[model samples]
Target: MVQAQVTRREFLKASALVAAQVTCGAWLTGCANALAASAPPPAASDAPAPIATPTLSRELPFSGWREVKYYDQLASAVVQCAQCPRRCVIAPNARGFCQTRENRDGKLYSVVYGRPCITKTTPIEKAAIYHMLPGTQSYSLGTAGCNLACLYCQNYTIARAKPEEVESYTMTPDDVVAAALKAKTKSITFSYSEASVAFEWMMDIAKVARAKGLKVILKTGGYINEAPLKELCGALDAINVDMKGFSQTFYDQVCQGELKYVLETIKTIRRENKAWLEVANLVVPGYNDDPKMIGDFCAWFKENLGDDVPVFFTRYEPAYRLRMPPTPVETMERTYKIARDAGLKYAYVGNLPGHTGANTYCPKCGKLLIERVGFDIKQNQIAKGKCKFCGETINGKWA
Candidate 1:
């Protein structure tokens, strides 16, 4: 379509000067014509201009800084952070438990904004959100730092590193949207490490992405405060919340977070009627793999989030500070059966490729609606979000 309105000759002539200047990083427009003449072939110059690119911006890549747009300074030099449930009253140079935000010199400044250390375009299915949009791709990006210190965190390299310890590129909100457009992704994910930690950047990028009709997904631990979550619900399309465990003991001893707060966050997400919500429980052996506990968890989910809310029991590997053996595949299969018995309609076993339980089955007819092999989708049998066999509508955001 760009070619229909503008001929190659006119387009080339119009863009030659800007292209020459940008290519040479030169501001001397007097030499633009000459530069274009001596430059490479017309085919090179005919290439379309980029939507947005990287820039020079510095943000801390650690759990060591505070960022807030709304806060008040107390007489004791404490800043009241309204960002998360932590609502930390931070003293100068002190950090939150998330270890990313900090109070510096009586004011709060989030240091991870616009400086993402990890950025890539990946399949949306890889985010493990099978029901949201199957086989679509999303632009995934994240900075360092997390609010929760889950000992079994899978991406701890960037998740646990400081700004100086990792490499990052500067980008604005527009750059993120451009990256999504350039990659032909249908959605963008604030993922890899933790989306809540880099809230400001995400808010900005989501605005532009939504304007462009691109979807947004939040791959989170559901450790965020209410206000931010509500603000984010405006632009977010889907969310996958990690339900680490069912008990406070596991939340404190294993994840170093509050179970009640995570539950509250999930409830709020459901109440807001915002975003397609899915829950994931990492089934760690000898930690949270007990059948009774898993059953209780499933029952709670069925009551609170409903039976239609899909739950994923992901097999845990030995990583980070926990060097224990990986969870047995048999255990994951057993848990899947337990969840099924607990009245949950859509329960899945993740991280074990080619497992029969990895595919999505119709809860009513017991027919496979979607087939999977690892992250690859081998087959899809749904028509307009209804089961092909039973004609019952699947409870998910299947677009």
Candidate 2:
């Protein structure tokens, strides 16, 4: 691993950086180094996780900025973005809260459309999606800027930075598809920062990914408006929505977001029945870890998402503004029990490798279905979407 890491700063010597070895922003060499160098050290928490780098490059054209498709122009050169539930009303020359969308004159343009700071190839399991193409590779990418203000964001190095603050690449949708193909990945994933913040790039890549018979997956906070989400779902094959917490108070205090909007986002995606959906709750200690709150969360999840949709209660590590200790394994176990007790068919735990909670068990015959070691699959007992032991029908898009 002594080889030079690819970042927008030193890697852009010519053009066309490889998709597998590029990291984002300044801190990422692009974001990891550049942003981390100038960014103030977190006075409250440990440093955020490093953005992994991708590799290779070819010169591609940068489009400056792409005009967004969802927005409403108002009088006096103001516009309201319809992309996320925030619906930021931006003035002329102003930017949205995500800092990736700007109102230039009267039109809203996506500033991070083709200028991702990172595009590393990883396993689909890292996307927190276990039901689809287990063990298959996923080509992932992310840009700077995030919509919500999560106090414990793990990738805050890129999430808190602006596109201008980071070194970026001119990766078009076709370029992304070509890279994914070169990497021999089964899906193209949008992750790292709030993927929806770079909605245009994701959508364009999804279209090309689909035409080329590659799956499209998303790891999102699910804080999006109804209309734009439906269109996004049309191309997405799988989605892992981060259900921050179950209560409104948690959202208000920790994330500075509305619980209602995220709830609607989940419902809209499920109701649309387009993408295979999974939910993850990062178990932040003492914040969203109350037993009663977890029970309520599971009950609501069972009622709304039913039995098939996989749910995860993952561990939270200290990062960004929040300096809480890593979530206890006991707490993770507690949430998993609560989810299963509420009659959920599929419940898993993450951020802890070698834990049995990471394995997939059959809801019907109580058989071990998929054994996973971190993001790697050890043994897959479920075959052809059915449990090998009991022939029970499993709910997932099997490879």
Candidate 3:
């Protein structure tokens, strides 16, 4: 049977209904029930099911750039980008190091505004945010371009590309919020690509999402400047920062960014107090997997963010520019132990599914509070934001 075509008006009405359900706290549970009831019976054929492409809004013509924020004008039509640590000073008709922002007539403009290359609804845990709103879904999106050039970037195809080099869908702030509501996701996540490259777009969509009572989460490398990071944090509800490594030398050689700036961004996020923060450290073999370095990272995390902040030691896989052997599971487990030993209460091992380290336990009583297999949460015993067994309050947006 052919599916009936949906007009824009009908789509808007449906989105409004879903938004209402979300506001009433009924969307997630209702969606779960609907999925179970509509489950298909076993099929004999082994052919893969066709994937459905998301129907995006019509492309909006642009003048190729929009006025940027957080920059300063310099001598002879040169503009200094204060967005990130690089602070690229562009001459007339030049672009920043990220290649997303350009200086047109001495005025900095973002070329990637509202042009997203990816959009989907994913589990919140996939963002490596194992604590906040566990088992929930988020509307995730990303645009091409990134401030940092990490050798082992998994999304390097888009992250390292200019806006003009990728196919993107045009979405305004209203369009993004509408899409999130239609997807029935609890939050909107800026992910995959470096969100800082598309800063204006993310900030605008985040503002709209917050106005509509939806949360905003950021998955970033945390290489942004103080002013911009503080402004973005105002609308953010949760953030997962990829810390990369502990040493400045490793950051310079492997990520093409500074360790100090990322650390400053993390500290700013904590100081803002508007967002719950989590950190991830990808352990690359022969690069930054030293036990002493891991221990120092944990100690710094404990000192700055405290013992309650969740940290994940993720196993690295060969991707993009890096072709080293995948990080061993034992290495990830050992790193996890180092964090735990350094006075961190919540530490986990990622990319090694079904390992006991992926589970969350009550800090007070050591009883398993949240059990997981990969990004799937099998059991969550957090009641009223406290451990069910010990009544110890967990630090997260559990609702």
Candidate 4:
């Protein structure tokens, strides 16, 4: 199938038009129409093909290797990946734990650069980032790897596979920005899988999106090193970090990661204060649903990330390697109360549609500010980022 490449000139024109619309307070209807009209149509033979199932294939394309940053070359044709805490020491022609970065003749390169296995325009809430751009759509995409090995990964089909094992479409940074503009989305998100595995691709696309006055949101697992995490925070407008569980033992056994690094990543984001930060913790039954553990988690969250930061206690379903039953609704309710009692203003229970906990309320007056059912926003009472009833300032990006 033929692929269309967007030229730099076309990107600049599209970005300029979007900027003008934002400045003049014009509706996105005209801007979207302009972008669609200017964009080149797909050739008749270039219709998108169905995505392939993940399987080992030697014939898959593997030529897209771009030099990676934040790595140290070691002796005897070995390299250490500094992108994440894993710090995988890969020998020549070997791959890191993520399986997306490889060592080619002692040089670490990203094999999934500009090759996205999934792309769609989805509600921001679906990313579990309930605060930023609440009701708006975000152009979301992800590559085919993850830094962690979570046993119950929902997207394990691609996240657990090697880059060459999945079918992907090549999209440059300009192509991604153009697609977002054409879709009439004001933000771009790197989601679905562990986006930290495709750090280079996301960073490049974020740079272009930022220049076009579009926000960049990362729905990540928060497993990166300090240096790279700080660098990524520079271009990010918002982030929703998944905090899996509270115990170090749980992390080591279930996620193949450590609790300290994830906490440090959250701390780094809060310290930088450059992006809107939100956190979610999936409550697995009989695992992390202990009342004491929940309370401890909430207390630590309140102390480290502050009480204003939104925290979500989501129900976990059986998937991947885990055979556990779905979390009980009562467990989620209890966890929500625990978070609220810990002084968190916006504590929520996710994965249970139509629950009262899904709505955002005013912390001071206890007035319902945003009414939501699942990912859809039914009513929003917060105007100009302030509670309409008590006129108290809400902590989020609302326009």
Backbone N/Cα/C clashes per model: 12, 36, 0, 0
How well does each candidate superpose onto the true structure, as a TM-score? 0.85, 0.86, 0.85, 0.86
lDDT of 3 by residue, 256-338 (tens): 98899889999889889888999999999888999999988888898998899899999999999899889988888889888
| lDDT (C-alpha, whole model) for all candidates | 0.77, 0.83, 0.83, 0.83
lDDT (10s digit) by residue, model 2, range 1-399: 699768775655434233322332221233334435767777556654333234333322235688898899999999999988888999998999999899988999998887777777788999999999999988888888999989999888888987777666666787778767766788899998898877788888899889999999999999887777898888799988998998888999889899888888898889999999999999999999999999988888878878889988899999999997799999999888888888888889998998999999988899888999899899999889999999999999997
Model 4, 25-87: lDDT tens digits are 222443544456657866879633222111222222457668898899989999999999999
Off by over 4 Å in 1: 1-46, 49-67
Lowest summed lDDT across 10 adjacent residues in model 3 is found at: 47-56
Runs of candidate 2 with Cα error greater than 4 angstroms are 1-62
Winner on TM-score between 1 and 2 is 2
At residue 28, give the lDDT of candidate 1: 27
Error of 3 at 259 (Å): 0.5
Per-residue lDDT over 262-306 for candidate 1, one digit per residue giving the tens place of the 0 to 100 score: 898888888888788888899988888989899888878888888
Model 3's C-alpha root-mean-square deviation from the true structure amounts to: 9.0
